[model samples]
Target: MPTGSGANQATFAGELSVDGSTVSIRRDTDVASERVSVSLPAVVSVTDQTGEARYPAFKAIMGAKKKPIQTMSLADLGVDAAQVGWSGASSKVVDVSPTPARTAGTIVNDDGTGAAQLADFLAGRGFI
Candidate 1:
């Protein structure tokens, strides 16, 4: 995002310790890293770096198995079903089409003009 890594974000956010309802999330990219603060009631995805996961014991598993499973719906959660998928999303796939078939690439022969030809090819493709 804006820092280099989660380590950088953590270092910036004081080990990600939040003082209020807002929580800091680590957003990272190759060129940058960022510390983003999301308020309560927001959707968030956490990583193992955030905290350690406690394994369930056999007794806990048996107790969970005995408990009746509760089924919940998006409606019950005050969420519309359509709002979660691609259709009602803020971003959408405007169009999609099958990929064009691959064609044979131009070859550069060991001729004196090979360098010039390669340069022209690269320049034509905006790769120069």
Candidate 2:
């Protein structure tokens, strides 16, 4: 992961490591790159920095077209129809409202004192 927003929410069910037998996760940091390995039968959620996915070759695509695909319904998976579909949802949304409009911002012109004005604005907003 590239340490982007919400990156800290990434988690795993098993022990995370730099090297292991089955699976591994690679992430980029501010100072260095990291590699985390996990045992077999593990689930990994990666970020966008993992790498560019390679396009499937034409032959592979053709082969995939010839493969048989099995489609199953919830009942086929031993699940009740009313317990998994939208009709069986536990909660309902009664109403929705639009977000409030934002107020106009303070614009500072470059008059040799722009830096000071910006510092003051940030301080007033408790950002500094």
Task: Report the number of the highest-TM-score candidate.
Answer: 2
Which residue pairs collide in model 1, if any?
A: 1-28, 1-29, 2-32, 2-33, 3-32, 3-33, 3-34
Worst lDDT run of 10 residues, candidate 1, spans 5-14
TM per candidate: 0.41, 0.53
Question: Model 2 over residues 5-94: C-alpha lDDT tens digits?
Answer: 232333432333444545656666678666665465444666655557799999999999999999998878787888875879999889
| Total clashes for model 2 | 2
Model 1, range 56-92, lDDT digits (tens) per residue? Answer: 9999998998998889988898878788977678986
Q: RMSD of candidate 2 to the true fold?
A: 8.4
| Residue 76 Cα positional deviation in candidate 2, in Å, after optimal superposition | 1.8
**TM-score of candidate 1 relative to the true fold:** 0.41
Model 2 compared with the native: what TM-score? Answer: 0.53
